[model samples]
Target: METTEKSVVRRFYDIVGSGRPEDLDEICSPGLVGHAGAGSNLAELKASIGSFLEPFPDLTADVRYLVQEDDLISSWVSFTATHEADFAGVPASGRRVKFAEWDLFRIRDGKIVEITQYCDLFTIMSQIGALPTAAPA
Candidate 1:
């Protein structure tokens, strides 16, 4: 059961990172909801992901860990991308950036029904020059 849950979560990331939006329906429920720092629903989540993918065409998420308990899966992921287009009103910086995030997913009937994410948004903004960088020591 744990292995199945972990595999579902892993496949979710794999399909997402592969830029295969069409495959989302197969893994995610129609009523999928995202909480915390992510979107609110499946459409919103897809749009958010699309926005990121637009700027970072090669965006990829590396799963540091995936732990499952019953219907819930917790994941630690590191994302890496090269800024090649505008993002969140910031022009392309042509820089490679990496960020880490923690996510919790709820799955039922072999589909992801809910998710919550915690990510370093400030660091991402700083990396993209949207936020001021720290002064040298």
Candidate 2:
């Protein structure tokens, strides 16, 4: 059961890395609830994924760590991409960015029902030059 849960999350990263948003419908429950920003449900989740891919078509996610307990899977992932289009009100900067995020997935009946993600938006904005970075003292 634990392995199956982890595989679902692994497949999610695979789909995202390969830029196949359509596959999400199979693994995610229609009644999905997301604790992450703007991804409150399955449709919103798919839209947010599409929105992100529009700017970073080459985005890839590497699962740095993964753990499953009960029906919940926790993953720490690293993502790399190049800014190729406008995002978050910032014009394209043509810069490569790497960021790490922690995600929690709740699985039921082999489908992802709930998701929560924690990422540092400030760091990502600074990396893409959407926000000013301070020089080291």
Off by over 4 Å in 2: 135-137
Give the per-residue lDDT of model 2 (tens digit) for 1-137. 44989999999999888787888988999899998753789888788788889998999998998898999999999999999999899999899999998999999999999998787667779999977577678
Give the candidate number with the greatest TM-score: 2
Report the CA-based lDDT of candidate 2 relative to the real structure: 0.87
Q: Report how far off residue 132 is in candidate 1 (Å).
A: 2.4
lDDT of 1 by residue, 12-115 (tens): 88987897766788889999999976699988878777777888888799999998888999999999989899988889999989999899999998989999
- Report how far residue 35 has shifted in candidate 1, in Å: 1.0
Q: Which pairs, if any, clash in model 2?
A: none
Q: TM-scores, in order shown?
A: 0.91, 0.92
